[model samples]
Target: MHHLVQSSLMRKKSMASSLPKIIRHRELHGEARQLNRMTCRVRLDQLECPYLVEISGVKRLLDITRECIFIGLSNDSRYAVGLLYSFSDSHHSSSMGHDEDEAELNVIVFELSATLLRPVKILIFCYIFYTFFLYIY
Candidate 1:
């Protein structure tokens, strides 16, 4: 019983020390009503997949200019997102008319963890290919 207690304590210490006390610059965007209802929503058309996230660890959430949203996550939160290959499209916007139209936007929330269950390394290897793709489209 004593051994088990010691092991559990060690695990807790390791977990606490591994995560950051604070993180910064995290943004999630999705549909407005949906964002209010759910923590995770997809709106941006540029990223890859959708993820379930917790927003409690996040420090600040802001809606920026209807075109972008700014998020500040805790250190642990940053590590959580960093492990993923790509985050879902957080938000997007379109204008209907000049001086008469407001764009629609979305908001998303993320779940942050203190420890990583799986560590993944993602690197973009084709800058040239990306540029070529951009030029073509």
Candidate 2:
């Protein structure tokens, strides 16, 4: 019984540290909306296939004259967005248009995580890839 408990703890640690199944990168020119009826009624942002996201009870309003590009999808309530404008707490004017000399880009990451159940799925994928590699060779 003691041995079993130790092994179970080890397994949990491994699962916690295991890498993700897959990852995709910075895409451009798209908008996505999954909003609640109350706070985020007016949906915005050019987010792609976001993972687990949770936002609630937002206050304040402002017009973003400059674009805020979506760097990557949200996962585990974390959204990666790239700011294509200056880092200012104040709103931008539409007349104060784009300038090459002052252009800036940035990435923001908040929270992200994932989990997989059992090794059966991985085994199946490995087998298929192994077969493909053998064929190529």
Candidate 3:
């Protein structure tokens, strides 16, 4: 087995150029004027991607991909779960509303694809944000 430090270095080298670009925030433009847009364009090479990839050096990464904030793995490492939150799909589902309700609370849940590298959609949540919570509790 390689030492932690050595493993880390190898990973860094392989992923250094493949690192993904994340969009922290986004704003919708009105019909009257369109000025605000992608400002987090990284290296200008991480071109817009629609799906995730194990290696991105050759392929473009999605400009708006699901954000995985947390993950939980089984003790035996046989099973895994993750929490993905992203607004990347909003533009396709419908025009983002100016307010919460209008936004339609665009949400999606993904599971690792058969390759164990890319994420595959397992659920597409279309619900009222606050109201959905109320029903749960």
- As for lDDT, the candidate ahead, 2 or 3, is 3
Please say which candidate is ahead in TM-score: 2 or 3.
3
Candidate lDDT values, in order: 0.30, 0.30, 0.34
Model 3 lDDT per residue over 1-137, tens place: 46998999877444423212111111122112112332322432243325643321224353333443335433322234444433334554454443343222222333322123233433434444444444554
Candidate closest to the true structure, highest TM-score: 3
Candidate 2 CA-lDDT value: 0.30
TM for every model, in the order presented, reads: 0.19, 0.25, 0.28
Residue-by-residue lDDT tens digits, candidate 1, 1-137: 99999999987544433222221112233211111121222222322323333222222322222323334433334432221122222241123121222222223333443222222322232111122344554
Off by over 4 Å in 3: 1-66, 88-116, 130-137
User: Which one wins on lDDT?
Assistant: 3
Write out the backbone clash pairs for model 2. 51-74
Model 1: lDDT equals 0.30
- Candidate 2 residue 107 Cα shift, in angstroms, is 3.7
Q: Cα miss at 4, model 2 (Å)?
A: 2.6
Instruction: For each candidate in turn, give its C-alpha RMSD to the true structure in angstroms.
Output: 16.9, 21.4, 17.9
Query: What is candidate 2's lDDT per residue for 1-137, written digit by digit as tens?
Result: 99999999987544433223111111222323222321221134331223332211122221221233435444422243333333322234233442323323333342332321111110001011122344554
Q: Model 3: how large is the Cα RMSD against the reference? A: 17.9
lDDT value, residue 132 of candidate 2? 36
